[model samples]
Target chain A: MKLTKSFNRSLWVFHLNTGSCNGCEIEIVATICPRYDPERFGIKLVGSPKHADVLLVTGPVTKKMAAKVRRVYEQVPDPKLVMCIGTCGQSGGVFYDSYNLDGPIDQVLPVDVYVPGCPPRPEAIVYGVVKALEKLERLEAAQ
Target chain B: MLTDIILTLAGAFLVVIFSLIVAFFLLGVDRIVTARMQARIGPPLTQPFTDMRKLFTKENVVPANAIPWLFNLAPVVALASAITILLYIPIGGFPPVLSGGGDLILVMYLLTLPALALVAGGFSSGSPYATVGAQREMVTMIAYEFPLAVVIIAIAWKLAVSGVPLPFMLMSIQANPVWGLVGPLGIIGILILFFVLLIVTPAELSRIPFDTPEAETELAGGVLVEYSGKNLALFTLTQGVKTVVMASLMVALFIPYRLSALVPAPAILQPVLDLLFYLILVVLVAFVAVSLIRVSMARFRINQVVSVYWIYLSLIGIAGLLLVMADHFIGVV
Candidate 1:
């Protein structure tokens, strides 16, 4: 993982939904609205995982989505950060202990930053990104 | 002869570096201007630089299904061909470094090389999305070529009938300002042709409103879905260079007048004034063609793109061509 200041400033994120309700996804969209304007920090929502430096994975991984999630995680180029958004991805939230369960995301792929809420507010998502940035900066310093 | 060769080599090196810098600067300006228009504070002007640097540090992924050599070759070819086009077109107040080596016809063909390289890359990536994108890109290239050819041929044709030597050469075109060659009716014709060319610029560069090949919402980055890291960065740079190419061509053909020619300036400062004027002209053309059109309109469907250029714009171009022809006949009689 080659961490640099440039990487921290311009993190192109690819959002993946692993079968959560659409709540987290809507919040993710809101994070990019003109009011929030994540682009000011050079953070953009790219369409492809290949172009992404940060993977914003929403939802707890359903059995069907676990493999796809893993593939997407792999697709992102190295030195990547994964943020598990919403409580569902952290511990299955409302879906906890379900019969078809395959995730709390971490079980399926490495999780770097977790934003926990039934559906985290857009502010929480932004703060989670700041935390991710701090982690990236720390990694840069350690190098 | 040796000195000529050395000077040409030096000029090529300087122009490449200068074009790269100017391309990035124009892209940054486009983003900021677009952001302001949308009522949002945009990223800083240095954002594209940071994005390019970050991409270089990331892993360069070669998809398992891809033809690695062709996939890797695409970006280099795209960027190189784009810069090659710049070498033949006038820049600022100076004539092209390789002005006599190639002319308008060669430039029209060179203009297609980057897009062809893109299509080649997209097909080689082995992604279903990339395949679809490549098809759409090819369609776009064909759709725009008619009006583009019409505009170029009309100008050259007009110059030829007027008995200007080497009408196909950019130097002759610049020297004989197409605007001055025609009368009232021809001015209207030239304006129409200019308008058609302006509409074609965005499609040529594949920016918004005509960016069907990379439609993020529908195809998920389309032709670029499988590209990552350094290859992606180079493609981004190629896009910037292509924007400069299209804008410079617009400047060369329609708005070739120089600030130095308009106002008497000291010999040394003349090029400086002309370069600044040229930059302003490029920015204005880009804003109208790329940024304004991008913001005001939504993407056109692939079929709509074909009809819009082939049927509508071609008609407008022909109308302009006819007017120019009429102006010539009327003048000769």
Candidate 2:
């Protein structure tokens, strides 16, 4: 019970930088700070998607990162959430026309929330995380 | 009534703005927290603001097949619904700028509006990816709603038995945590709620492991395949505001201890200080949530999600409810 309680309270979020200028990546990092506090939502960023309840992917889906991104997505267990952290991840943003881009993060895995921005704001990321957590709980209930 | 509406409108607007401002700062905090978790230095506080400004000036586009009115309306509804939820929920002694007949149950449904709007927008886009996202969203909706509802219902039962008749709105719950969080059953309900709510947070916000609908790798932008410019910005803003809303909701339900100094102050200062205090608590909640994220892993399958919550959370919630009832009968309150 405690484990389940803690598991629910502490949702480990992972970040996958498929390919971007590092703009959204930095913002993603900003979300966990004391100021933005993703922890309030029971959200944290894990180094690996395997340990993440929510995999937060930033940047446009680049061809180079596609397979790796997919691999990471596969590693996350069931009831996991995927969040496309930026416009790039959503629709490729400015990178959409780039030959190296693979389109959006949703193309690779299911995304519960899409925080759209060339790089979205930290609060937006937090909001998106909360939404995903809500989705996670709802899914848990139905089962 | 007119005066009340005006006051409510004013309060709601302020809360909306406050939520937005808090969201940007929270974004900065999230970055810093995640960075430190990984042993790295994060960006400055103004980073999110700068990014938003940059996006505001970026090019806007509308897809040919998309319903322009609905597409434009989607993000607006999302933002509005989030802000509206915030308004209805009390943070500490603060009642939503507005309150009505229903309680937490109403807030729960109101919260789902943004997601519903997203699904609608996605389907309206007429793209395969968007449609797929909508479908995933629907499934996700089902996956999470039951457990959330169970938790809410349990809490409501507690409130009912206590004869407190909670506003069913989050604000009333927050204002009188003493009344809301009363009894051994209340505590158990809260504990069960802790798990249930924790699970609900990510899915509701559409964050990770469960983010299949908008999975960049599979559905591209998912529901947002064709959104751009202001429409996209609205969605982004909705996300930001919703983050604050979610955190605030948790704090409202769990931590209702208020700033002792605020009550003695002037009425105008009272609300401002109250708002600030609520934001601080939300920050704390976010910090705790982030710390938890550092160690946990995301669940992969949709089925697993359903099974875990339904089989586990439901039982837990039910147990808590029964325990509460027993405690009440035993005069253990």
Candidate 3:
């Protein structure tokens, strides 16, 4: 619906894992499958942050990955959005208050959307993406 | 002389525009067919256009260690050289823009320019992944070069032996469809050569099965890891154009038949019929060589790619050449 912004339709996502179990990653893969087919909306999982319009971050930040996450965030050029997936990246999930914990991802990056669960369902992640799109539209309107 | 120069310049401009459209069509068909084969409704046909527009507007990032000038220049050279090949190779119903100016050998050499530019860009990017990718790409180029040369040389040899003038010329090749010249034995030979070229097509375009150099999963975009924004957009455009170049080459070589020739039409509409038929051929080639192969096969290991081309495909291509040679001698006897 945001016709003016070309990136609105073609959103190339880069997936980053600070250090959670692979639950959110599996769900993300499911969302990209034939049934969900995010590619129908031109959403693709890109290999490099340089190629990404959206950064999908899963897992809580471990001590070492904190800097790596920030570096990748910097690598994704301007007009970028970050979505923190799963409760691990939101409130640290089961790893809450751990010694090696560097985050809740919001501490490390500006998260535009948060889909929280032990590992959020694929549908919930897709809804979170819709929310991200809405946020993008609002920002465009403000501009 | 001045008018001639003006005519050529104008013609060249038209060819550029025409090839770009065909290139976009090839990309759209590839993506949509790939999606459908996987049982999903794909993105719109104009997805490439939208993606290109978005890439142009995105920020161009020159990595800290990259040689900025070469990094920027590579994509321009790649895209320009890709368009350059179209100038020599006849497309649709029309003669090549610079028809008779260059020949098959020149086009063959020109085909390497874009890939060379890619290697230059990859090496210039100063990333370890890109360095490895550049090397892999160079190796892939070397591996496939022999089989491709075998296919072209065998065709031109047949034409030359059969008393055709300027057998290497694109016009000559297009004017005389190869299928007509050969006996049944030679027909089998030509089909094998055609098969060789078809397998090589994916490798030439760096699609799946031969996409080790740009292995997105392991190498993280590999040779293109450091490329972004307008530079990346230009590279993507180069890819689309190269797809058309390969498809056009295959169509011009194997299936040069014009629908207009079979179904008589108005003089004005003949070119339209020819162009439409050419497009269908191009799409079919792209589907078989790019989309279908890409969907069915996973990426080959770089070593496996080398063996497939060097050991297996080269042998197959040589056997094809031998059959063509044998058929020619037997006909004379």
Candidate 4:
């Protein structure tokens, strides 16, 4: 589905945690601080995936969580984006190639933007959101 | 007669549009005020409009197990009934389009229609989370209903006791301005009831300190867990419209005074002044009932919700009712 500027502006994101050690989760929380205030851009954290336009995935996918992540990705309505929020979701961070692992999140779901830090800072999360909007613009231009 | 009917239909259409504009503006103001209270820059005032556009264009998803017909109908019912409420209550200096002798009671009963639509929607969604939410919504409705009734009846009863014919008419209540009919003791009582109704406003809107049904952290959107796209957008609209309805009700009941009376406006300018003044009052009332308390409190447990309204607010409402009655029978009202 082609994206519109309205879709880009009012991005309702649902955060998914597969197997993060809580580092990225803390940064995600920090991104909502009065200092950061993502709401100024109309970025809201919605509880239901069905109401979301974007999914923020953090942490490497554990074997037990792989299916749940897939289920959640499908739960979001059409015209969606998946943003990988930490290095853990890209290369498993310190847990790379460990037993009981099933990820790097891209293996289980299509990731549109990756912010690669062991745990990215809140500033990085904000940049990741900007990059996501740029990607939307690219998609709109292509159409 | 046919032309008359067409004119009424056209007028009703215009009023519905006006109400929708006010409702959305109220929601945007709410977000901005809540953000400022938290020391954050909020979304633009046009954010709700942007959201509605995106939602209308997005894909509408129906849960496989859900009853499709009922699911689709719920949102339409919810929005329609909410807008229906705006038509019965007086706006600015104009009488209600459908004004009648006892339509205050009609407005009270109509207040429950949007809630009932929500309950129906939740029950039909076929999700365990929604089922729990529907139950909580039903419980919240039952808990808040008595005090709501008490508040309305107290004012009307005072009007009756004060010798106004057709005391149940909103026009009568508008003419009387319950605040003036009461002496000092009754003033205190009316103030108490005013406070109780302010507290009840959050519950009626399912806002925080009473928002267990949609507790996001726990139930993941609860009753709305399964709704998506257009359906969710309609429910969102219903929420904004309901806020306007509750705030308007409070305005009509307590502060229905017109600015034209004070300023002595010419005939051409009377409605313009009254309309501007009415909007200002609605904004203030919405700030108090919806935004202020929402920012100040946390969600209540379902059990606590029941006891708070049933035991605490009910007693307070009855006390106010008695005082209004007493102020009439005794001296200085």
Second chain alone, TM-score for each candidate: 0.99, 0.87, 0.99, 0.97
Q: What is the TM-score of chain B in candidate 2?
A: 0.87
Give one digit per residue, the lDDT tens place, for model 2 in B59-116: 4555567788887788888888888887777765565676665467778889889999
Candidate 1 is scored at a TM of 0.99
Question: Best DockQ goes to which candidate?
Answer: 1
In model 3, the runs with Cα more than 4 Å from the true position are A1-4
Cα-based lDDT for every prediction? 0.94, 0.69, 0.92, 0.90
Candidate 2, residue B332: the lDDT equals: 48
Q: Which consecutive 10 residues in model 4 chain B have the weakest lDDT in total?
A: B95-104
Interface RMSD of the candidates, in order? 0.6, 16.9, 3.4, 0.8
Task: Give stretches of model 2 more than 4 Å off.
Answer: A1-143, B100-102, B166-172, B178-186, B261-273
Model 2 vs. true fold: TM: 0.66
- TM-scores for all predictions: 0.99, 0.66, 0.98, 0.98
lDDT by residue (B215-294, candidate 3, tens digit) is 99999998899998889989989999999999999998899888988998999999999999998898989899999999
Cα RMSD to native, each candidate?
Answer: 0.9, 14.6, 1.4, 1.3
DockQ of 1: 0.90
Query: What pairs collide in candidate 3?
Result: none
Q: Rank the candidates by DockQ, best first.
A: 1, 4, 3, 2
Tell me how far the alpha carbon of residue A27 in candidate 3 is from the true structure, in angstroms, after superposition: 0.6
Candidate with the greatest lDDT versus the true structure: 1
In model 4, state the lDDT of residue B208.
94
